[model samples]
Target: MLLRDKFCLITGASKGIGKAISEIFAKEGAIIIATGRDLESLNLMVSDLPVYSAPHLVFKMDVTKEEDVLRVFNELSQNKIFIHCIVNNAGIMEDATLQMVKTDLIHKIYNTNVLGTILPSQNAIKHFLRNRCGSIINLSSIIGTKGNLGQSIYGSSKSAIIGFTKSLSKELAPLNIRVNAIAPGFIDTDMIKGMDQKFYEKNLKAIGMRRLGKPEDVAKVALFLASDLSEYVTGQIIGVDGGMII
Candidate 1:
C-alpha cells in the first residue's frame, strides 16, 4: 500500500507503460485517473484495473489540447479531488533519418511528445503548488541521451523533456514539489514491437542484460518515484535501460 489513498493522474494510460503504471498504482492503493485519446481502450483498461478502496476514473483526454487538459483538472478541482502525482506518459514516436524526415512528421512528434507533456504539467503544477507537495514523473527516453539512427525528431522531443524535468525540479523544490524523468530503453511494448527484428536484436545485444525491458520494469521504478521511497530524489533522469549506456 505504498500509495494508499493517493490520487494518481496518468496520461496515455490505455496501454504499454502507462497502462502498467495504472495497474501497479491501483494495486498499491492509489486512486487512478487514467486518460488517453482512445476512449474505447481507456474504458477497457479502467474495467481491468484491480479493485481498491478508492474508485478509479477514466477520461478521454488529448493532452496536447489545452482546453481538454484544463477541463479535466477543473472538473477534478470542482469535485475536491486533488491529484497527488502526475505521470506525463502521453507521447508519440515516428522514426526517419534527418534527410528523410518531413516537417509535418516533426510537428506531429513535438506536438504530442513535447506540448502534450507541457499542457497537463502546467495544470498539475498549479494543484501541487496549492497543496505544497506533489510528484511529477515525466517519461524521457534513452534515445534522447544517445541519439538513434532514425529517430532524430523523436530524440529531440524527448531531449526537451529531460531539460524540462531538470529545470522544473529546481524551481519547484523550494515549494516541496519533486520532479523527475524516467528514460526507458527498448521496453517490450506494442510500440517497440513495430521495430525491425534485426534492429531489435541488435539493441538486445547492446543491453547489458541481453534482453529487452518489460513495462513492469518501468512501472516499478515509477511507483518508487511516486511514493515516499523517492521523496528525497528529484531533478534526475533515471535510465531503465538495463545498463545500455554503461
Candidate 2:
C-alpha cells in the first residue's frame, strides 16, 4: 500500500488516465476524491474502484470554475478531510493547424487546459500551506515539449502547465510541498481513439516501444509522484512516452 490512509483528489477522473489513476490510488489504499463534470461516468468509476478501508468520494466539478473549485476544497476542509495529494488531470484538446485554428477554440483550449489546472492548484496550495506538506501532480503532454501538427493551441496550453509546475514547485519547496508534471505520449484513451489510423501509425512508429501507451503506464508514474517514492522529487517533467522524444 504505497498510499495507505492517504487522501488524494484527482480531476477529470471519469475516464482515461484520470480514471486509471483513481483506481490505482485506491488499490494502493488511498481514499480517492474523484472529480469530473460527468456525474454518471464519475459514479460508474467510483463503483469500479477497489474497496478499501478508507471511503472514496465522487464530485461533479468543473475545474475551470473558481467557485466550484473553492466549494470542493471548503467542503473537504469542513469535513476535516485533509488532502494529501492533488492530481490536476482535467484538460481539453482540439486539433487544428495554426492557420486553421479559430480564436474561440484557442480560448476554449486555454480556459480548460490551462486555467482549469490552475484553479484547482491554487486551491490545493492553500490547503498544502496550512498542512505544511502535500503533493501536486500535473498532467502535461509530449506535444507540449515537442510541437506536433494541428496541435498548436493544445500544445501551448500544456506548455503553460509545464511552466506553472516548475515555478510553483520552487515557490512551495521551502514549505515542504512538492509539485511536478507528467508528460504522456500517445496513451490509449478516448482522445487517441479519435485520431486517424494513419496518424496513429505514424506515432506508433515514432515511439521506441512501437506501441501505444496504456493509461496504466501514466497512472504508475503518477502514483510514484503522489507517494513517498518521490519524496525528493519536484519541479520535474517526467515523460512517460516510451522514449518517443528520443
For all predicted structures, in order, the TM-scores are 0.97, 0.97
Question: When superposed on Cα atoms, how far off is each prediction in RMSD?
Answer: 1.1, 1.1
* Tens-digit per-residue lDDT, 1-246, candidate 2: 899988899999999999999999999999999999998999999998887786689888998888888999999989988889999999887898999988889888998999999999888887787767999999999999887988989998999999999999999999899999999998999997788889888889899988889999999999999999999999999999998952
List, residue by residue over 1-246, the lDDT tens digit for candidate 1. 899988899999999999999999999999999999998999899898887777799888998888899999999999888899999999988888999988999888999999998899889988887677999999999998888888989999999999999999999999889999999998999887788889878888889988889999999999999999999999999999998852
lDDT of each: 0.92, 0.92
Q: List the residue pairs that clash in candidate 2.
A: none
Give the clash count for model 2: 0
Q: CA lDDT of 214 in candidate 2? A: 97
Cα deviation of 231 in candidate 2 (Å)? 0.4
